[model samples]
Target: MAFIANMLMAVYQTNISDLFEVVDYLLMLKAPSFKSVYKWRLEQEHKLRERIHAESNKTENSHVMTDTEVWDFIQYFQRITEECLSEMPARANFLYELDDSRKIKFRLSNL
Candidate 1:
């Protein structure tokens, strides 16, 4: 049972990580307007916060993580997303001002 629980937690973490990766890739395309990107980021943040709150209240089979641990994870991810979102306007401006001769490289090092 412990092994299964650990496996489930691992899978959950991977899925969340992958979702963020997809979002990062989409943002690199800059196909969506800045407003749309900001909206999506806000939505994601809200969803994550809700998940953390829900998890914190769980009592059964709570070996996956303690409430404090969940809060820490939430804070860490929120800070990362906030940093990325804060830089979006500058990145968008740079992309807009760039000519065909120049290309900008987007890095997800912060993640």
Candidate 2:
């Protein structure tokens, strides 16, 4: 929740008009289930796009994404998440097969 609030703060700092909406969205974000939060996020994304379009048009800077672009983003994000999940066991097994010393060495190698 704090992370989300921080991100939203950055956004609202750029456009004060969005502060109220961000506050309201954060309030609805207190749901106890992932499904509920996902639903709200989708709905809020569309609403935000529309709001941005309307606001941008007033400034002669229309920068709304096409439907295909939105769909592609959604698809790619889900695909990446699924791919990461599918690779999780293989990743875990790689570490599990290593001895303690090698595991520490491998971890430190990344650093």
Candidate 3:
């Protein structure tokens, strides 16, 4: 979960909007039970986007994504990571046979 939060923070700092969506999608794919929170978070994201669009209109220079977009994305990512990690087991033995290299590769590829 800490790793997830750190990666999400990095994504926000990089201004990679797609990664925010991807993380949400990945969490949903990993656990169908988290669908409700995922959808709620998506709605929150849209609201944040709308707010950013509105705020940018007041500026002389037009902007694509406002600070609110990054802030909200970071908040949602943190919340979702916390919720998801709380539900998942500390460690699953299903992949015990695979070496760490293969496991990390599979995890990244899956995301």
Among all candidates shown, the one with the greatest lDDT:
1
lDDT of 3 by residue, 17-38 (tens): 5645445333222332334435
RMSD of 1: 14.1
Candidate 1 structure quality by residue, lDDT tens digits, 25-63: 333333233344444555555676667669686445534
How well does candidate 3 score on lDDT at residue 80?
A: 51
The global C-alpha lDDT for each of the candidates, from Candidate 1 onward, is 0.49, 0.44, 0.47
- Backbone clash pairs for candidate 1 read none
Single out the weakest 10-residue window by summed lDDT for candidate 3. 93-102
Per-residue C-alpha lDDT of model 2 across residues 57-99, encoded as one tens digit per residue? 5523444445555555565345334544354334332322223
Between candidates 1 and 3, name the one with more favorable lDDT.
1
With a 3 Å backbone cut-off (N, CA, C), the pairs that clash in candidate 3 are none
Candidate 1: misplaced stretches above 4 Å?
1-28, 58-111
Order of candidates by TM-score, top first? 2, 1, 3
User: TM-score for model 2?
Assistant: 0.29
CA displacement after TM-score superposition, residue 57 of candidate 1 (Å): 2.7
CA shift of 65, model 3, Å: 9.3
Any idea what lDDT model 2 has? 0.44
Listed per model in order, the count of residue pairs whose N, CA or C atoms clash below 3 Å is 0, 0, 0
